[model samples]
Target chain A: MARAGLNAERLTRAGADLADELGFDQVTLSALASRFEVRVASLYSHVRGSADLRARIALFALAELADRAADALAGRSGKDALAALANVYRDYARTHPGRYAATQLRLDPETAAASAGPRHAQLTRAILRGYDLTGTDQTHAVRLLGSVFHGYVSLELGGGFDHSAPDTEETWSRILDALDSLLRNWPD
Target chain B: MARAGLNAERLTRAGADLADELGFDQVTLSALASRFEVRVASLYSHVRGSADLRARIALFALAELADRAADALAGRSGKDALAALANVYRDYARTHPGRYAATQLRLDPETAAASAGPRHAQLTRAILRGYDLTGTDQTHAVRLLGSVFHGYVSLELGGGFDHSAPDTEETWSRILDALDSLLRNWPD
Candidate 1:
């Protein structure tokens, strides 16, 4: 019989916690079952399988990150908003490395379309409003910002900046200043 | 007796091929042994364990990528060199997704110091020579370029750019142009 108190929400929360404790890639249905002290079969009632569990976790992470981004971006504009948004991502990654990694999971087309990804894109466009870009230029700028934020954070978390001169914080601030300047004076 | 044809180099090469076929995270000592039709114990003579195998693969990928970058940068300067370097990374990632992913693995400080990572830094600085940046600003520029190239390629591979209009290629070319322009006019 299915566990009386277990449900997908609770199970997924536990799974996310497990991911945080272990690594995201270490998450599996078998491990979650062990954590719950239930048979692996019991999990099937809540989560379809490993793939379903991962997809749920990915959705949860996207929603959570999107919420944080939206909150950080509130009541801010221009460079302030840009910095706030960028820090939100970096801070979240540092605090919740597993969940942040989950946010990078490649979902199927259907799941991706239904994900909070569009909200992220909209947020990026909102930041671009402070600058004068329009049309294709705006789209290109969005990709650039996404690349920088994602790349820098991934590299930092991977220890790329460790044992190097000039602390990462200084480099981060300088990069932001350069990005803001570049956006302000975007080429024609 | 140890397999006559089996050695650490051959095993590492086979492991790299396995990584390319089944993804790096899936490569294991047991799998390689099975591939060789040898007992797992017999393979230990050739590879210390899975960790050693992964480290070797990472080192191999780094050297290969650095070599490609060196070749691409030869006889090129300015934006041409930048574009060539960026394309090398992108193309390599597209052609060898597993090896490219391995290049992102976190090696110990000692292992990293001995890897071709410093060669990559030198090449990045070489490209920066075309710009007027020096000292810390040059370091910041190197980080920025690394972030963009790594981030954009990671996102593109993760299907973040799929189903979008204006095409990813357009964005890539425009991003390079913007980067070149930004480097030319870096703020004081």
Candidate 2:
């Protein structure tokens, strides 16, 4: 029989926690099973295998990130909203490095389409609405924002900014300020 | 005697190739040994273990990327120089995803300081000179540029832009143009 309370959601949550603790790439069915004090075969009832576990973690992270972004951006606009949304990502990555890493895993198109990724793109567009861009320019702006947030956070977390001067926190605030200025006066 | 052709450099190169063929996370000493038609013990003569091999790949990638960026920036400045430098990174990442991923790996402080990463920072600073930034703002600009380049390329490689409209290429060029404009008129 299955473990008394085991199910996909429970297993997924545990997997995310494990990922946060052990690093995403280190997550495996065997590790989860060991953590749960169950045999590896028991995990098959909850997840197909390593790939499925990773996909679940990815989905979990995307949804969590989107929800946090939506919360932060609920009543804000312009640079206010932009900073709010950006912090949601950077803060989450700091607090949950492994889960944050999981979000970067490449999902198949079908799976990606069904995940909260669309919400992320939409949220980005919503923020850009205050910037007065339209058509392809707006799309380009959305991508720029995405790249900045993802790239800055990734580099920061990877110690790219650790050995530098002026402190990363100061630089982050300044970068955001610069981005706000860039978006406000976006070139035609 | 050791294999006639095997050494740290040779093994590191082969490891990078293995990383490209498989994935960075999948590159292993055993796998390298298997590919070379040699025993696992024989491989130890060169690399201490998986960690050492990965570190070598990271160093190799940093140096290689630095060399390319230096070449691209040799006779350029301002927006022209920025475009050249950015293209070098985006193109290198596209052609060498695995090696590019390895570049993102966090090296120990001593190793990172010794690697060609300093050259990358110098090159970035050189690009900023044409923008008229100085002191902290120049540092901030460098960080911003790093984030955007790293962030955009990473998202592109991870297929984040695959299902989007206007095509990634359009957004890329527009982003560069926007960056050029932003740098030219950076807020005080």
Candidate 3:
């Protein structure tokens, strides 16, 4: 009965919720089917397999995150733009920890190429365009931004900032100031 | 029988190597025991269980990485220090992919407190001191350094940098230059 009502979109949303509850790694087809109280073969009509389910989750997370980034970056420029962009990720990771984890799953090259990952790069480049970086340097700056943003967020999510020092949020704000300044004065 | 010759150290090293080959998640005690041509019971004598084996691999990777950082940072300061520190991690990941993956495993707070991970933070702080920051800003700087270094290396290792543009090496150099500049002239 439930199989007739199930669709890829609904299954993927269910999978994302399951990811939030039991950590991302535990979201498998069998487990998902059991959650839906549907037989495995019945569930197969909606999801191709576990990998397909995961890819859908990843796509969902990416689109949601990209939308959030677009909102934060709107009407913001310079250091303000940088801070807002960085905050979007940190906030998302804190709020939807499961969906955030799904964003980091290994996608095949084609899936990755087609995902909202490009939107992410485009947004970063848009911010950088306001700065004075050139060709190869611009490319390098994009990579640096990607690395720092991904790195800090992942670590913070992993509790790398639970120390008795200044909280990571404060640190994150300062790093953005530093990054904005770094972009403004990229070296020769 | 081989539990007779095996101990925690050997098991940890073997686990790290196995991680390098099959990946961190794939490095199970049963798989490792088979590799050693021994029984699973023998491995238990050296390592308490699965979690213990993983913790040991994480410890081994952290220490090896820290030692490599020390060697690279010796007689180096400022930009040179940053480059040396950055290369050590990237190189380690390239050479021992599995061990690097194990290093990302979430350790228990107590185990993490007892890990060389602190020494890693200290070394990073020391490198920042070679720049000009102090107090809480130093902590921020340290977090930034950790984020960029770990983020870039992990992304590159995971093929996040295999774009149709310039190679990751060139991007890495420019990133180092950019970071050095950022550190040298951290914004107020």
Q: After superposition, how far is residue B8 of candidate 2 from its true place, in Å?
A: 0.7
Could you give the interface RMSD of each candidate, to one decimal?
0.6, 0.6, 0.7
Over the stretch B37-99, how does candidate 3's per-residue lDDT look in tens digits?
Answer: 888887777788998999899999999999999999999888888888989989999999999
lDDT of 3 at B18: 90
DockQ for each model: 0.86, 0.90, 0.88
Best model per lDDT: 2
**Which of the CAPRI classes, incorrect, acceptable, medium or high, describes model 3?**
high
Error of 3 at A184 (Å): 1.4
The residue pairs that clash in candidate 3, if any, are B19-B98, B20-B98
Candidate 3 C-alpha lDDT tens digits along A110-155? 9899999889988888888789988878778888998999999888
Ranking of predictions according to DockQ: 2, 3, 1
Best by DockQ: 2
Model 2 chain A lDDT-worst window of ten:
A1-10
Better of 1 and 3 by DockQ: 3
The runs of at least 3 residues in candidate 3 whose Cα sits more than 4 Å from the true structure, single-residue gaps closed, are: A1-4, B1-4
**Which runs of model 1 end up more than 4 angstroms from their true locations?**
A1-4, B1-4
Provide the TM-score of chain B versus the true chain B for each model in turn.
0.95, 0.97, 0.96
